[model samples]
Target: MSDHTIRAEAPGDEAAIYNLIAQAFAPMPFADGDEQELVNRLRADGDLALSLVAVDAGGVIVGHVGFSPATIDHAACGWFQMAPVSVCPPRQLQGIGSALIEAGLRHLREQGASGVAVVGNPAYYERFGFTVIDGLAPASEHDQPYFRAQAFDRSAPAGTLRYAPAFG
Candidate 1:
């Protein structure tokens, strides 16, 4: 049986979430080592539209995924950015990260978000229906190649996609 359950972040989950994120990204070559801080910034700036955590049977947070509002063409298009998906090293590769992401996306959809964007491996995000739209792009040229998006009930717009300020 699975040892963890996915759910919304609670008031005291910040410290656990931060530690887990730092541990999860520490070994990744692409990680900038500020992902944990980014999450804190998002929460402080009130840009974290949604945050979910995976809790083990013992009540420890083992995974986390954050969703923040984003803009397309510099307009409020109900788009969000999914980022820093993390699973503790000891608990990695057990689908914990994927489950957190799916739960986050599902919540966003129910909340009427028009779409979600992510900058990551195509092979991974593609499974969640994220794809590169011909005319849709990220504001940062460095992110252009890795950026992908998935539209929900509404059609995605073409133009620069800006992530929340905490992403800077």
Candidate 2:
């Protein structure tokens, strides 16, 4: 992880970030071919709570992560949703995604987020303290096994974990 640096996303990273996300999830069966569009809508709608990127020694963007404000009952709680976490095609399993998640979570905490939710692999996200919460998930994947949450407040909220309108 020392070889890669994680930082907040800056201007001029849109294209690279889009490409990286598209490339990373290109092989996934669950992908709706809308990951990049989701990120774009989040950004355009000012719902992107945190956008982070991992750059290698040469300053090449190898990974990216986006956390957007989520609603429990339609914007009633201070929660965030880890939208899309992506690593370059050749850079998978190299800790780049982990670094991005760690840094992104830290930033969310600093921003006073109460909890975070994600629709991701349980095995990989559990290391970050994400666990499935009963009845806590996106509208479409309600109560699915892959839905997970980690509360910085130590008390995860109840209700549906509604992502930004972009996720729809």
Taking every candidate in turn, the Cα RMSD to the unseen true structure, in Å, is 1.0, 1.5
* Stretches of candidate 1 exceeding 4 Å from the true structure: none
Alpha-carbon error at 48 in model 2, in Å? 1.2
TM-score (all chains, Cα) for each model: 0.97, 0.93
Write one digit per residue (lDDT tens) for candidate 2, span 58-158.
Answer: 99999999998888877658888897999988889989999899998888888778988888788999999898666566666553678889888867477
Question: What does the lDDT read for residue 106 in candidate 2?
Answer: 88
Q: Which ten residues in a row have the lowest lDDT in candidate 2?
A: 134-143
TM-score of 2: 0.93
Q: Which candidate has the highest TM-score of all?
A: 1
Task: Give per-residue CA lDDT, model 1, range 24-94, as digits (tens).
Answer: 99999999999999999999999988999999999999999999999988898899999889999999889
